[model samples]
Target: MESSSAAQSVVETWSAEATSLAGAFRVVARHHPDDIAVKDEENVLGYRELDDLSDRIAARLRARGAVDGQLVGVVIDRSVSTPAALLGVLKAGCAYVPLDPAYPESRLRHAVGDCALEIVVGDPKTVDQCGLGALRVVDPGAGHDGGAPPAGEIEADASAYVIYTSGSTGLPKGCVVSHGNVLALLRHTLPLFDVGPADRWTLFHSACFDFSVWELWGALLTGATAVCVPAETARAPEEFLDLLERERVTVLSQVPSAFRALCRMAGAAAPDLSLRYVVFGGESLDLDLVGEFVRHTAPRPPVMVNMYGITETTVHSTIRFLTGQDLDGKGTAPVGRPLPHVVISLRDRDMRPVPAGEAGEMYIAGEGVAKGYLNRPELTAERFLTLDTDDGPRRFYRTGDLGRETESGELEYLGRNDQQVKVRGFRIEPGEIETALRDHPTVRDAAVIAHDSAQGATLLACVVLRDGEPGRPAEAALRRHLATRLPAHMVPRRFAFLDDLPLTLSGKLDRNALLGLAGAGRNGRP
Candidate 1:
């Protein structure tokens, strides 16, 4: 490993073992067949049971005409059946597309249509809700969901899964994750976390979100138990704590939003548990919020990590841990260094590496970088691109995120560069405007959406009223309020009142839908 700067710590990278996702599961099954691999309140399955069910699912898929290179859809909740459905698809040699059972019909239909999925595996009890025909369905009633040989010696480059992310341009596209990418991620991360057979990982993320990709399979790869938390209970404060204590959870990862919710059960209701590790991702974490949680939880776990990554680079790339001392004085925690087999580079517009401490687009190149998007070659080229860093020809993903390296050599988060607003022949980031709005006394959550009309685009602010908001402020007064904090051009042109901002299935702000509503109002259609 070579240093990019004299002050920064350099991480080493080298070739390591990589294999198909299913192959990783077999290692656990062989070593810990009786260890509880997955569990929900109603059901539980050990490594042997999970592996056999996956084999049966694969056999069922093969019986119904599934083949490699084809895609199969799995519509289910976070349950024992999920791993089996995923394994079956992989075992049958086709990539599995996971669909949240609760997704809006239109969104679910999009993946089905785009992937041309024919065989769907789910619980027969709830298959009616999916309402798709021209496809064969496999449910829990199907016999012998286990006992088939592993798909032998498959290439690491095979498509392991296809995850669809909300498209900023308004068309959701599926990013194809390869076996090599996942294998690389697990291999690199295993040592960082020091996970082993003694650990029990809490599957805390939604199946649709990329974090679940790590939470579900990461434990399996390391020969640890993946204790399941059903989606319903995972989000509920009281129930979630109970699950953690009851299951004896050792490893946990979730979003700041979840931590906020769990903080409600502080006193005697919170889990009477001791976790070895607790990690957070999925959204920006404010130092203030993290402080509140640490203070409330008291004797916190040793492994409190802030991780960062997107679906295009497997699940997570960087991780940083915090000790009790680190949070005593509130400060933004740095997302730690990159995992093994991965390299993080800061590059400018023309793909040239930037000097340390200069803000630029964050580029990620590594063993776990996804091959590309499914059937989206143009987008694949646009996002997953090439760069010539000092190391070598690197296949880098232009992580739309803007970041700067500190004098300490740690990467600092700046917002997104193309999340744009144009005024006076200059483009500005709306995140800056929203950050100011969120500080208003009467605002709970604020989102700014850019509207493009014949006269070009303007920013509109959507505000969720605080608990006791003083009704709606006069438009002029609102502008005056913003003027004190931001430049005149950055003031929101129109303010819309919402009890809550719309969110995607993954619990992220749905800016696309907000802009659509704004357009309808502009035309006086509402």
Candidate 2:
């Protein structure tokens, strides 16, 4: 076996030569032509086969008059075609804008109009259902005349994709990521692991979420297999666990809330798994539940890593490996050091660096920083600023997340600055209260949201109880449990019991949905 350092050196050497994502994938395909590149329920494709299919896709796009740097919309389901369509778009020198078919018609319409998309590649049925009939649609499954792809060299700075994230103004904003940005992320991060062509990775996230960017490219660029998980299988814990075990997946990435359900099922079933890495992202992880999971895994557990990142700064920024010792301490969740090409600094509202152990907004500056939000120049200018550094000057994206550095030099996520709510003159972070609630033996998961009534704003907690528990804990008892760990004012005023918390399509906590549920007061009491 090669030494870890030697493996890392090899990865670094080859990755440095890569310019565009499609170009890098072509290099891998040339070397491992017969290797499995992707697989779905209906089809299995080898590297060379997928390459040829994508070339045809590029040929079709060129025939449709797509020019370099133009935006092409992709409205497809999660399957073998998804990767081919995305790769085809990039290979044709056009950036892809993923439009999930599941999104509402209005949201889809907004994305289409905002991007000024002229052509879309999608399943005919899905395109019709999404009401995108105005734009020309190219079916990925349709047959095309065999022809060589357009000959051209794509620049590293060229846009690869535009991912739309929810905006505070009740609309969606797109972030433009370039080929170099993604290459930098892979070059710095992939060398840390011992992955090879034999490994199988799961594409569990939707194409719309930035997490899928990591999942898809991480496998393809490294000559590994990407097993496309069906939408229904991804939502069902039991089915997802079976798929992992049956497929012998090696690398699994999930949002913390989604993993909690899988962990619970795994604790009971104890199915044999082949996972080497279980990466957590998309939300704050509950360390108490992590401890429980570690204990259940016993003698040997997969390397569980909690990654803190934002869509604008690629998929990952800081990474912390979770060990038993980390759970033994009372310290907050640590999101570890930055990736090799990334720089992280915590600063106050005035852009001054805060003292160590003091909470401040996180500002990221590095090769992985994206080009900026699409078409919204004012918003982009406000969020992405250039700061003077010892190295002269560098651009940084101001992340609204709050964090503090520990004495050990690792970052501990303190929750989002916007999530802080004030109740009766006391500013409270609901994450702290939710953490306290999860620490209780009977509580499995918890979400706290501020609800405003005619009288005033108050904190309401929606909780999921652990399985096999005798009965629901009284509201007063739950409150007393929280009182011991939190300040009196931080305790929630209303308590609600839920079978499971509402989650967005990206597997994140739906705060808006939670607030609505709290208002309904289903199985809740003051």
Candidate 3:
């Protein structure tokens, strides 16, 4: 009882002081001034150095006409400068919008114009190469005077960053996440893990993705070292594994698709490492693949955690810790429970709660919910909603994801609601068929898409066979394997064999590219 009371007091104290991200980071920097904060290939920055550098960057932005409550574009590659630039923007009282230099020029222009960016912090050479020289650019590496301006006094509700996500309208929409939202997420979730100054975390994803937000702050706020993975190393499984072994990364986060490749490499030669937690997010986890990887890790495997979240939910909403026992049963991927501060409800089309086991659209409410989409009022109104609960009126973000409560009270994630398709008056989920394909002995990875053919809308299966598997199985044989597990209408009619599935820059499956492969005459086999 005394311990419980002490925990309550700690929470209350943190709630009062840790209002904004910049403020929270300042507290950490003060405590761990000499501790390493960031480590990139080119540079290593201690907490005090990082703090001082960000202040100088903030001064540069302020001198370049950046004002409070405005959006500042950050178009830098992943490095020591990247975090400093983002922190600088927040310090200047402006939200940072990450613009990937690798993205198409048109996309960068769209984001710049959409957010009305006045000052962009990036490498001067990258700005010119990306043809963003027209905008006012502040080079983070440029020399600055010793007298740095004071950090901005920002409100807790003020926007911290704007991350752009692919929209249904073909254009990208920015999700505005406030400083308080992020602090709430960290305050509730960090206690679950044993993170500390000695730990090392990887910034594996691009800054454009919200997962990077968690990776960056998850380390800085906790005084852990944020290891910046280079683009080339991130693409190569062997090199990335080498990095993990060399850096002694303790908390590793990955999307399942990318991790699958690494698992295959680990099967051949397991590297010596000190990974404490392997957190999976960005996509659904394939239990069979992860189970195999766990077996290979042997005596002391890292704690495997699967997290379900979206860009609008400030990185993560649900958390589940996995074990060998979880894989023993009929392989099921459960995303566990919501964070203490988050509230999740599975609702039907009418916004009413569904029965315990029935699948429904997920509604997430709490401090983790983003403010809303930037410059998209109508769409924001449609997605972000208010409803009356037992606790009174509360605002919730209607996650288009489909999920159901398990017998254990944990949430089981079904695919996206929009991914559900109707063909010949029968509703089907492509993920169901994909899972069936993956269950086959020879198939390593599988993706199923509904294709509009000359006949009608039919399902197309794209598969990657196991490396040492005999010759490719015939389409009919694959169909027979799926038929035993799925209904007749659910089995895919056509198949496409690929050496590897296409993936986006962020490592998620590239659905559009998969659809293109399905439609291509040479790839599809009836």
Task: Supply every candidate's count of residue pairs whose N, Cα or C atoms clash at under 3 angstroms.
Answer: 3, 0, 0
Would you estimate the TM-scores of all the predictions?
A: 0.85, 0.96, 0.96
- lDDT (10s digit) by residue, model 2, range 125-223: 889889998888888888785456666658889999999999989899999999999988887888777777788999999999999999999898878
Cα TM-score of candidate 3: 0.96
Instruction: Please give the lDDT score for candidate 2.
Output: 0.86
Candidate with top lDDT is 2
Query: Mind giving the per-residue lDDT tens digits that candidate 1 earns over 230-345?
Result: 77786567888888778888888877645655654644464467577778776665555556566655676436788888899988888777655667644356676776677888
lDDT of 3 by residue, 374-482 (tens): 9999999999999888899889999999999989899999989999888777999888888888888888888888878887888888888889764345577887888
Clashing pairs in 1: 52-146, 56-145, 56-146
Question: Could you tell which candidate, 2 or 3, scores higher by lDDT?
Answer: 2
- Candidate 3 ranges with C-alpha deviation above 4 Å: 1-16, 145-147
User: Clashes in model 3: which pairs?
Assistant: none
Segments in model 2 whose C-alpha atoms lie over 4 Å from true places: 1-17, 330-332, 470-472
lDDT of each: 0.73, 0.86, 0.86
Q: Model 2, 330: alpha-carbon shift in Å?
A: 5.7
In candidate 3 the C-alpha lDDT for residue 362 amounts to 98
Winner on TM-score (2 vs 3): 2
